[model samples]
Target chain A: MNSMGLALAILGASISALLAGIGSAKGVGLVGEAAAGVVSVDPDKFSKVLVLQLLPGTQGLYGLLTAILMLSRIGVIGGNAVELSTAQGLMFLGASLPIAIVGLFSGIAQGRSAAAGVGITARKPEHNGKAIIMAAMVETYAILALLVSILLIYNIAI
Target chain B: MGTQYASAVAVVRTMENSLFTQSDLERLINARDRKESETLINSKNAGTLPEVWEMLRTFAPDSKELEIILYRNDFHNLKAVLKAMVSGREPDSYIIQPSNIKNDTLKEAFRTKDMDVLPDYIRETATQAYELITTTLDGQLMDSLIDTACMKAMQESAEKSGNDFMRKYVNLITVCADIKTAYRCSKMNKNRDFLEISICGSPELDKESIIRATLGGTENLLSFLGNTIYAELSGLLKENPAEFEKRCDDMLIELAETSRLQAFGIEPLISYYIAKEAEIKNIRIISVCRECGADKVTITERLRKLYV
Candidate 1:
């Protein structure tokens, strides 16, 4: 119960959620500020800008999902209770780092790209698809990071 | 590319679809009558000249960029007031009352002869121009004083604003004005002293060399112009002075075209404002020509490039 491994695992999971969530929040907020400008002049564009506003939000969900998976793996969410060694805990923390770091940076980069994409739609609403595509391109690195985090966590011995 | 301008740029881009196109200008050019042309123009924007000016005012956020644009109008009003002071009566013409310096302030300054009421930038030029006109009754001398001041104000404001696009704009404006002055002075057979008083330029242009070349006459001036970026202008100046004048407007429109593709920064807003101004100028030219039964060639010659 007093295992340092459990503490490290929890800390790692918490960071995975915290950093990614913060990054997505900032990214979404940036797009929202830009969207507000267009919407002020043309309120008809609310739906289009709203779509763009949500693009950066995916990172937060990815973070939450990774955190949940890690929590479950660590027996914190109704699983076989096994106290972990410090090395095991540190390994879990290391496994969580991919998503925590990459998700944070990629989410922000995605948000900026999406904000710029929102500008395209604001100017040419018919080209919203292209704008969406442009923003979505930034999601690749984030998805790769998510996969690495999941793969590493899944393969780590308990 | 500042984050603050993101939204402003977006709104401007959305508004770009509403701009008059080159084909739209052609339609105006080929319109059978003035009424048809006016109908075509009103259909697009649905506003008079004043409303168009209003859009130009709001399109730019209230920043140093907007101030730079508005300064042209401010100095033009200064010219109007200074000219009226000598005329002993205000002309019933539309004077551009800028945001910083209002029409009332301009009129009051003219009436009171009070430098205190005027903005510090223009106070000296206004005083100098007023004294020159009153003492010698030289309208041209007064105009040169004001013109030099206007150019100086433009150069300072553009430089101080620290916008690269604006700095380029200032250079284009300064070089064009210098060329026009040199051309006019050469045509008049004026000397170095007159060129010193009349020609104002930016660091981008070598005004002294230009003045010296201009001292040698139109051929030397043309040879000097041939060596600069304005080499194309020399041929136009030789072929037709009117067409040469159009190059300045075209230069602005060309630069604005680059802004049309831009999705970020204050440039889109700046370009849109200039584009709208060009649109208005073209429309006015077409309308007046159609009303007067002037030829299409005359109207087309004066028409500026379209933003769209």
Candidate 2:
């Protein structure tokens, strides 16, 4: 039984969740602060700014999904634990890197875009869709990273 | 770039929508009577300058950079207090609102002769101006000294904050003040001593050159200004001081417009204050013109540029 391999796989899963969660937390918090400011001035704009605030939150979900899939693929869930070689554990770690790194950065980047979008919505509520589209454009990279992470997790030889 | 004051900037953007537009000013100018104009202005729900200042302070309390915006008012209050002390008149009537220093604090500092009670930016100037006014009893001289000190303080603080927007703001203010002072001094035939003390030189308009040109008379001063980047203003200064004043204010609005593109930072917050100030100024002009029964063309010419 390679405990070190299981430990490595667990470490990879933890890293994916930890880094991406931090990014989303930071991104969401930034937008929340800006949205609260607008709402404080004009309460009617709450719904518009709320949408902007939620834009940066997707990366955290991607990270959680990646971690769950990795844990399940390695049989760490369902009350079953599979013995993995050191190379296999390392491969699992490698698979998590795309989402871990990309999710972390894209979350913050998307948050800034969304926060700026919050300003647009605050000023011109009629153009709220433009702001949403601009912020959503940053999500494409995070989606690509999540796809790659899932593919690697599923295809890795046990 | 890193975004500072993200929340404050957004709030300012929201507030920007409430500011007066050009057409609003036109309607204000054409209002049938003072009552109508007042009603139109009140309906806009544009907050007072003090209210705007309080809101900004709530958002960016720690920003020393934003404090520079009120230095002019602070210095004006200082002048008022000193003049009141000299004339034995109450300063309350003349003291301006939205000042960085409280009126009571300024009065108390002067009453007790404890300059320490004043903010560090104005402490030395207050002390020096107090001493100069009491001894010489020269109100104009005291005013020049305080005005020069105000410009210098604004420049130093803006440079220390390393904010380009503030630096340019201070520069524009200094240039306009120096040019106005030189024009006035040249007209009065003030000596070199007065010119040297009154003109706070800017990078664009050198103090020594201004003094020399003024000594040569208003013609030389106007000629010197004509060659500078502010050449367009030279014609306005020559024909009408009122137009020159309007041009100076319009230039400030033009500068504030540049900050409108900025999404994040204290620049937007500062520009909002500028916009609000212009809106108030426009309201004041319309009220006064309506009271004086000034024609639309005259009132329209005097109205400063709108931010929106």
Candidate 3:
């Protein structure tokens, strides 16, 4: 029963959720502020700006998914916690790093992009799809990071 | 770091859509009568200058940078109050709104001889101008002093704010004003002392050089201006003073256009204010021209550039 190893793995899961969630929180909050400004002027714009506001939220969910998968893979969720070596614990931490780091940055960056998109939507509602597409472009890296994190989590030897 | 004012910028962008477009201005210019022009303008629902100023204040209440935009108006009001005090007349009619200093505050400052009531930017100028006007009874001198002080305040505040957009704004305003003052002073055969007092120099146009050029006369001043980056303005000044004034305003609109590409920060807010000012100016021009029964070409030529 390598307690240190299990602790390290749990620490890894926490970092993934914590860092990515922080990023998403900041991102979502920034866009929300901008969206609220537009909505204040034109309440009819709620739906369009709301869509832009939601763009930065995906990183947080990806982080949560990574944490849950990592936890399940280590048998922590099913009440059968595996005795992992220090090396195995380090491997789990490494696996979470991609999403933890990428999600943290991409969320904020995407938030900025989406916030600018909100401006476009505010000015020209008809061109909202263009704004959405521009903001969505930043999501590709977050998605890739999520994919890498998931693959790493699933393949890590218990 | 410059991405500050995200929400404010967003609101400005939304408001930008409501600004009068060029075509709108054309229609406004060609409106059959003053009543029709007023109707066209009213239909735009573009908020008044005071309303726009209030909205901007609400959004960026803490922005010292935005306050610089009103220095000209504040100084103008200060001049009005001082003149009214000298002439034993009420200043209310001449005072403009959307000023940083309230009308009552200005009047109180003059009545109580307490400059402290005014903002630091104008406090000293108020005291000095009041003394100079009361003792010398030189309204023109007082005006030059106050106008120069306004330019100095604008430039100093813009420099302190470290905002390039504001710095450029102040520079353009100072240069245009100095050029105009020099041209007028040169035409009137103003002395070196007057030119020295009136022209608040900028990096682009030095105070000493402009004064010297004006001393050499209007030709020398125009030649001096011709060599500078603002050569086009010099030519316009020589050809048509009214056109020169229009071009000066158009240059500011050109500067405001640069801020349109900015996504965030106080620049966009400043840009919106400038755009709105131009729109209002265009409306005023059209109204006055229509009232004067000026021809369409005359009205269109006088119209300042539109932001949209």
Candidate 4:
């Protein structure tokens, strides 16, 4: 492993994080807007809708963790900075692909879910807790993607 | 035929046949001793209580069936009240039953969206419930839409594969929904235009019988429906409704068991969700009983057999 390879791995990890972040940002934005509208009418509902809107932000956090792990793998944190060969760099890149793609799409879908939750809360507020819990359950898959990315970066030696 | 399809049908059929007989339901429900009633209810898995209640509701309207429905209703009422209280709305006037709403309370709650004016309990539960609702956006249509989609999917699955299991499953479910709705509409006949929603499923009885069975038991709808079904239910109220609902549950449980015997694991899964819902029902029941100071023996006796 050389500095060039390590540099490539760093780039790959950054790209994955950037992609997931973009998705999460967009999703959270969409849900936040709808939640804001709902809150305008029912100001007391701030806590519930806010929590729901925040859920999509988890992907971004997961992506950031993955990027950090990728950097650490290159010995970027310790005294000696290692590098990766082209093959090793490509492997790291490929490993991050799954999370990047899944994170992007699920984030948007979850936003729509947030909107629906908003409507339900507005109509039958009593059912809101169970409703949000169900939404959170859907967010689990996205977090799983982050986990896989972290695990992949951890295993890489670049 | 594909082995998978054939097996599924065989399992469902086996379950359909083996459900609890009328006598079995009576045995559990009509126990002479308090111990016997408590034993029947206590022995059940608390979780399966809701689905058990649903199964009972799907069965034909009868006295025994009504008791199970009432037991289930009691849980729902408690949940609704609690939920309403948390939402900052006085639950005292909220409609606790699905088809029934407390006309006055509903009007009051629906009129204003202010949380400050509501009682502390209503505010807390409502806020919690509101949060949950905002989070599960896609699930907004889950309750009513899923029922429709489930029927459609079952019908399609049945037609393409010649699978009677899905057919039977769909039939039973459809009948259940129809009866529930019809009973609802009949009760709302007082303000028929405002209360009636679209009716879509079976149990295929005339409008009169459906109204007769569901109207009397549904609380708070009496003033609206006038003097309908009240006389009949009051006369036979104690034993029949509970017995009938137990039979329905027995049917579903039997259906699931039959599928298990036939190695159809999925059948049990269906029962599992239903039973899960039942467990929630039981929890609410015990909580409500505790809150309302209902006699322990009476509350215990009303509980259904557990599924899982």
Candidate 5:
């Protein structure tokens, strides 16, 4: 029964990570396309746009951290298997949901910002640093959501 | 009075509309022929200068002044400089815009070796700013104080206006001022007066903090974060002033993009103003670069992307 509970919690984390990361992957891919368009115009602007594109990739990192934390809860890291009650399983699901959903939307939003940044860079190359910083601002909330999920998963007990 | 103010806005709107477009800016930046570039600039200047003059007439019909208050401020400083040269005095030009203190009056007073002909108000203002320059132990002290006071005034105005454009412009100006001050302080390696004369509205980032944050440009100093996200964002570029400015330009672009996305009524007007200003500056840059015979690569790097 303990192993079964452990299996469900780990499964929850994996599913959340998959959903969150897919959003991030799509986001970064969109920004990358925008960046490629900008670079085609002026090769020198490559490094600047690259930073803006990298902002969306942070969501993936957050999701991966959530997965790792969830696995640790199941004692996949340092201890024997710990089983979570059904309540704990629901808690894990609730906590991860915010990150997954917010991460998806924010990631897409970041891509839009990156596209704008790319447009600016095509004209004002120096503005790249500022562009990346602005996109990063939107990403902050998503990261905060990721942190919430990690803390929630950590507090859960079998 | 309401009609007058409305007309002023209308004139400004019309002038804003007539400003050089993005395509004009690109043409200016890319122009290889000197005569052609000058023709473009002169024609643009000719077209806008009259509109601006007309607007000023509409604003203060009787006065009909040709002066740009800000640009004249630069002229006022230049007058201070010329007077100082004639009188064997070192005066601070930063506190008062050069054109404000009556250029002809200052020159006349200086020419006669008498400061009395200058208006009492102008003389008093110049004297206070001058004292800061003359009494200070060195050039460094004077520069910091004047820069601080200007930055402080700008910050206060920005805070007071609270309108999005005014606030953002003020913040942008303050951040740039911070970068300039920090750059000066780090290079001179001055320690005692850094905080004393630093701009009040900045987020405090110390010398080690700035060096760590910017990675290369400045050394020991403090940075004060203002009441905006741009303030903290500025810290990341505290090390490289130029890079920080570029970042600011990008932030403006982001703001413009967001405004476009939201389809806010006022946003387009503001964005067009910014973009047009960038266009004008880019043309000016091209003119200077061409005159100075700077290479294409160098000129391109310095050109604001929006304009060129």
Candidate 6:
């Protein structure tokens, strides 16, 4: 039972990182393709397109932060070892779910928007700032999810 | 869906800067001599007609894209060869040499008397057109045969593309050409026999109604068009046929440019190509008008709207 409790807690940390990381990877790949397309024509605009390409990558970092925070909160890192019951482990998993589910979907959606921003930059570099803002708007949901997961994990009894 | 043309679209975005503006076209129209026109074109790093055409050929994304845009030339060359061959003239100067159908291959097909060398879309008409003039010596009959074949090929290709814009373009061109054909046949007093072979069929326009209207006369034709999407065309046809053509061409440009705002798609790439083609066509028109020493007013009236 103790082993199962530890396993579920580890699974929760993994989900937060893995799902969000996968989403960000998918998003960043899509944006990179768009950036490559723009750079193929105008090599000078690489710097501009690079920013758009990196925008969708934020969700991955957010997910990683949530995973790290949750890992540390449950004394699974360089802290005093604690034998968590199955219900407590399940609670930890539930808390991580906010970031895990949201980050995954939000990352891919943000990447698509960022790719569109790259197109705008390719055509009219002057509007790149506005394009960036538009793409950044999609990251709001991911940020909200991160905040909720952090609050829940922090309040969960050790 | 649009990713296939990402690189090409990117390239097309850069190419937009090269399209001639209104003032540039006005200068070309007002140029005094061929040397002056050549100077203006060279200033922009685009030489004369053939040079600009070569640039487009070099930049086209794929052979299918090339085929769609240049098939008219291919059909024109085949028609020219059919006409020239019967008259004992060399067909070299008449051929446009499409990427898909090589001019040399066509020349060889003629020399060897084997039309199989030609693409399927053209082989039937090329053979029929050649035999058409050879047997009857009727130039009009040969002309209609090739014209019908060209329209059919365009229709089939547009249908195959499954693109809405392409289908609309096909509809506009066939309908416009049919209107012109109907007008010409009216004066010639030709009956429905010529109409049956001449008019290109489109799902957008009822061929039977148009044929009936054409047989009835201009009033009947105008009445029929009034009820269709081309309602405004009836008035334009009565007032000025040239303006009517310009309006239809403008509609096509608008349809193409609508895709320009799209972030991802082959639509923008294809639209840019169409716009460039229209620009080149206008240049050719103005260049020819200047060479012919046409009056500025007449030349201005004939010039189609520049596609920017």
- Best model per DockQ: 2
- Per-residue lDDT over B124-187 for candidate 6, one digit per residue giving the tens place of the 0 to 100 score: 8888887878899999977887887788888888778777767777777787777777767665
- Give fnat for candidate 1: 0.54
Clashes (candidate 6): 0
Better candidate by DockQ, 2 or 3: 2
Report, to 2 decimal places, the DockQ of model 4. 0.01
> lDDT tens string, model 6, A1-158?
38666667778889999999988998898788778767865799899888888888988898899889888877778775467888878988988898898989888888778887877887788999998999899899999999999998888775
TM-score of chain B of each: 0.91, 0.97, 0.98, 0.39, 0.62, 0.88
Worst 10 residues of 5 chain B by lDDT: B1-10
lDDT of 2 by residue, A22-67 (tens): 8899899999989988988999999999998998899999999999
TM-score of each: 0.89, 0.98, 0.98, 0.34, 0.46, 0.85
Encode model 3's per-residue lDDT on B104-221: one tens digit a residue: 9999998998889899999999999999999999999999999999999999999999989999999999999999999999999999888878999999898999999999988998
Worst lDDT window (10 residues) for model 6 chain A?
Answer: A1-10
After superposition, which runs of candidate 6 have C-alpha atoms over 4 Å from their true positions?
A74-82, B1-4, B27-36, B43-67, B97-99, B108-120, B123-134, B293-301
Fnat values, candidates in order: 0.54, 0.78, 0.62, 0.00, 0.00, 0.34
Model 5 CAPRI rating: incorrect
Clashing pairs in 6: none
Q: Which portions of model 4 show Cα errors greater than 4 Å?
A: A1-3, A78-80, B1-308
- Residue B114 of candidate 6: its Cα lDDT? 98
User: Model 4's lDDT to the true fold?
Assistant: 0.51
lDDT of 3 by residue, A88-152 (tens): 99999999999999999999999999988988988889999999999999999999999999999
User: Stretches of candidate 3 above 4 Å error?
Assistant: none
lDDT of 5 by residue, B1-308 (tens): 01122223222333343456666756776777877787777776534433433334444543211122233253346345654654577665433622334445555554575667754324433445456555653555544555555555544544554445545655555565556555565566546446456543444333344433333334223343333344645465555565666566656655554444321123333454455546555677778887898877777777665521
Error of 6 at B158 (Å): 2.8
Interface RMSD of 5: 15.1
- CA lDDT, candidate 1, residue A111: 78
